[model samples]
Target: MSKSYSHPYWLDVPALKGQAGQPPDGEICIIGSGLSGVSAAYWLLEKGFEDLILVDDQPEIAATFRNCGHILYGTVESMKALVALHGEEKAQKLWALSIDVCHEVRDTMQRLAIDAEYRQEGYLVMAIDAVEDREIKESIALLHKHGFDSAYVDQKELEKLGFRNVFGARFEPGSAQAHPTKFRNGLLQHCLKRGLKYYSGVSVKSVDEIQGKVRVQTERSEHWYEAAVIAANAYSPLLSRFFAEHHLVEPFRGQIICSEPLDEPIPVSIPHSFDHGYEYALRTADNRLMIGGWRNHTPHGEVGTYDIGVNPEVEQGLKDFVAKHYSFQKPLAWEHSWSGIMAASKTGFPFIGPTDSARIYTVAGYTGHGFSWAHGSAKILADVMNGDPIPPIVAEACNPRS
Candidate 1:
């Protein structure tokens, strides 16, 4: 799939060579070349920020997204989970802003001509039991109360729609998914054309605010910039030792699997999730059934973003669920499995603004919705970096202090 999406293996893409006598110092340095960092770099370069340095631990760009199958905006249900903690007004605001983020991802891809196979096919969230069915009903009401579009699907209706004995479900109309590898790489190539310099395979040791500048020290070199954006997400806690005490971000691992391309593609590319988003699946552009998520089954053990191999139980559960759902008498014959660490926060939203040191900014802890929120969060953070006043909606939804 090289050159199929984002420089296939990052070949021909640019990288910063600190070992080759390149200066570590820059006016602006962005840490981590994942989706969040790349997205921020794209928006920042568009706003006239140049000579920027992008660094990552991986050997290539969009490595994380490469494993992801879909990017549907599906966090409204999570907002409902947080309503008890954040209150109704705040929940509605968060819900609305999240929906906007979905639009943001689509609009940005279109504007940048990022060919990530962007498709607006919507998503299907199902509930298999009484408790989850109740949750779906409440979620629909909440979304409708806020004037968003969502429709409920009952057991009989779901059966007719190609499921057996489904309890209930909801459809999020404006949702969409993309070929993640292509999206991130496409964005990276576009940003490179606009003068974004990225360095890969550089392990960042620490980040600190010294005297007046933010210093980022990697295993091979150290650099100081006017300011820095810690876009590492889950990896932030490990890299930015100074901010770990604030306990701002916690890393969580998300594992995924791929099944053989279906002889016939599903009628539509509607992504699926249920059990409070503890499970999810989607068909890839190549018509493969890719699905994962069930960390709740191994809740305590699944924490920490380190490179822990896939849990056998969790992986097996994913295969079994897919088999049962699609009515495969035997297993679906798993094609591939993999995992990566992602950031989670006390709040479901990202910590998208300034850190304790106003000069040191960050955008992490997107939970598992990084794809849904990363671009818009990056744009908001970029707007702030350029000294533009933070818009009320952004401030309301992404205030780090909150």
Candidate 2:
């Protein structure tokens, strides 16, 4: 809020950042000010597209990151699922995009001077039993087939590395973590410097194609644009009839817990997942363990709606998980807890192309991997919108209709 630059790079002279004024209709509008929305805006600007408006219902920017567990840049295992559904070739492109997104975020942090506690400590994916272990082994073989580098850590090696209760793990380099809220704020500030018109508390009612252009309707006003990017994640279907009946862009509850700092560090502080990604944990900068994603606890209760409220039944399961997995000198007290809604498409990959109308594009359904996919997805959206050539695999593997 202090300042993003000596002057707003694209704002009119003497017009400050966060100024309240509407641009002429029929330009470009990005709905949702979360990671994907902001990333798309930045990429579009880099490609010389101007007159953009960023709309969100929250009063502040990057509201989603503030409520997230943590940010990690690993997608190797997540990609395996894609390969099964879409085959090897297209999945490879999506995997490349995920890794490329990680590199792009790292470089952007350094270039923009973002203070997000960025770390590239790598990722260790732990399996619960033989079933998951076999899956992990096959994933490694598949990664090898696809020319991606990863190493398997046996039980002994895992114990040596300070992990427990797993047959094996897949250690992937280039996996990174960061303070999510700071990273989002930093990106928002950087985009502001380049003249991003961000409006908060603007609830969008619908997005429809009017006369071959995208028209956005909100509670306060109406506007049109050459294109509209739906990066709202779970809220996409709610805002537009285009996605309502698709039934794939589903909203589910994702909650996280922030434990009080521990006196000593756990054997490993790198990010880890257990039980087929139903659970994930990472060490925080303050040395506390932040863990979440136990929808398996109350599987039925986790789905439907965008309510950011915690489920008490699932909360109990997470507490038991903490006591079972790690040791502490004293009883650990939970410091904070919160939940957010996330979207997932039937494809497991995000929907990332123009909709029925070429001017209307869908960019949501990140399936809980938005942090890794948003930036690259935005670049792809930018490429497609700016008439630049895009990788064909993206069109095939990530097509919204697919």
Candidate 3:
């Protein structure tokens, strides 16, 4: 791939630019025009909040648009690890939330008539070693016990599926994947049609609660709104002293690479990950293989930075993994490589709902699962704002105040 396009293959399409509307007054201000921000605007509009403005610093690429586009549930961690981290009860609720979000996003895509190349073929998590094999078994068992659809695939089964892996795997049914940029573009067009005033190239500097409204300070000028939501994801802390002082969210950079179409494709019918979710690869609908993840190999260097530049060492690590794991009929070279900044919340979950100020709210820090969390978080934001009842897990685990 030429070095000209520094974005993932998903973002190779034409950019969707929005018109800059009149200055903000009583309209709600949403910082960041990514999935979370756009979804928030969508749900708010659905709930009768028509006066809204979505702004982004970079109109070319929203952080969420730079991901691998797999809308799988749960985090990078397995179900067993999730149970250990937050206990069985909360973990079950969290899993349920992810499943619901998956369905919600799919329904939204269908409802809006989007041609985003969506596939509900599920996801596979391969275990590269004996330890991971055992973890996969336990994770599948836990998922099954919680009424989730999951199964363990032994090495023989994996081999039949064209995997050269040494151990078993965990297969979770009902998950889906899509063209990220296409989905974003579709929803953005819907939002814009619903009277959403969008402004690009407007970098937000700070958000402050004024006497009766919220003031959003941008590089160009300051705009006041009746309310504001900080959906800036990895850039959240940079927009507020409170989020920075409280250490709410930290930035992490993840990289991805797309290879040229193979002469003969492997039976990678669905997306799969290995090495404890540090690495993942999937054969696109067009037969090109896209793989990413290696932050573990450069943990310190990958974290605490908002830079989206490709990391050469991590890139090489991915190339080596592909060479070692799969055998294709023809030699393949990478055609595209890019990186995106992700926000890891203090607790590995997202921060949604109201902030210290009632007039100000937030929805960020999905770790690396913002695609699955955005619509659900937006629904929760709308619910809270509409004075509707929310799931107990959301109040218990996703409360911004807590």
Candidate No. with top TM-score: 3
What RMSD value applies to candidate 1? 3.9
Regions of candidate 1 where Cα sits further than 4 Å from its true position? 1-23, 59-63, 74-79, 264-268, 299-301, 329-331, 392-397, 400-402
User: What is the C-alpha lDDT profile of model 1 across 1-402, one tens digit per residue?
Assistant: 122322222222343332233336878888877778888998888788888888777634233553454566546345467576567777777777777877888888889887877888888888868988887788788778877789987887766655654588888888888866667778888888787777667788888889999888877678889888888887788888645877877777777777656675443467877677777877777787777787778858488657646667877887767656664433454566766677677666787777777677887777777786888889888988889777775566555553
In the range 1-402, model 3's lDDT, one tens digit per residue, is 677446678767765876664356657998888888889999999999978988888865567777888888777678999999889999998988888888888999989998989999988888899999999899988998999888888889887777785598888778788887888889999988889888877878999998987999887788989899888888889998768877889998889988877778666778888988888777787888888998898859499987888889999898888777776656677889999888888777788877888888888888877887887788788877778765678767765453
Clashing pairs in 3: none
The ten-residue window of minimal lDDT in model 3 covers 17-26
Give one clash count per candidate, in the order shown.
2, 0, 0
Candidate closer to the true structure by TM-score (higher is better), 2 or 3: 3
lDDT of 2 at 232: 85
Q: Estimate each model's TM-score.
A: 0.90, 0.89, 0.96
Question: For model 2, how does the per-residue alpha-carbon lDDT over 1-402 read when each residue is reduced to its tens digit?
Answer: 123211111111121124344444748888887778888888899899888888777633233553333345445245466677668887767677778877877887898898878888888778879988888888888878988878888988876765556688888776888766566678878788788788766788999998877889988788889889988888888897878867758888877776667787765778887877777888887787777778866748588866666677776788788776665556677766656777777766678777778888767787776776776688788888889665676666566462
lDDT of 3 at 258: 89
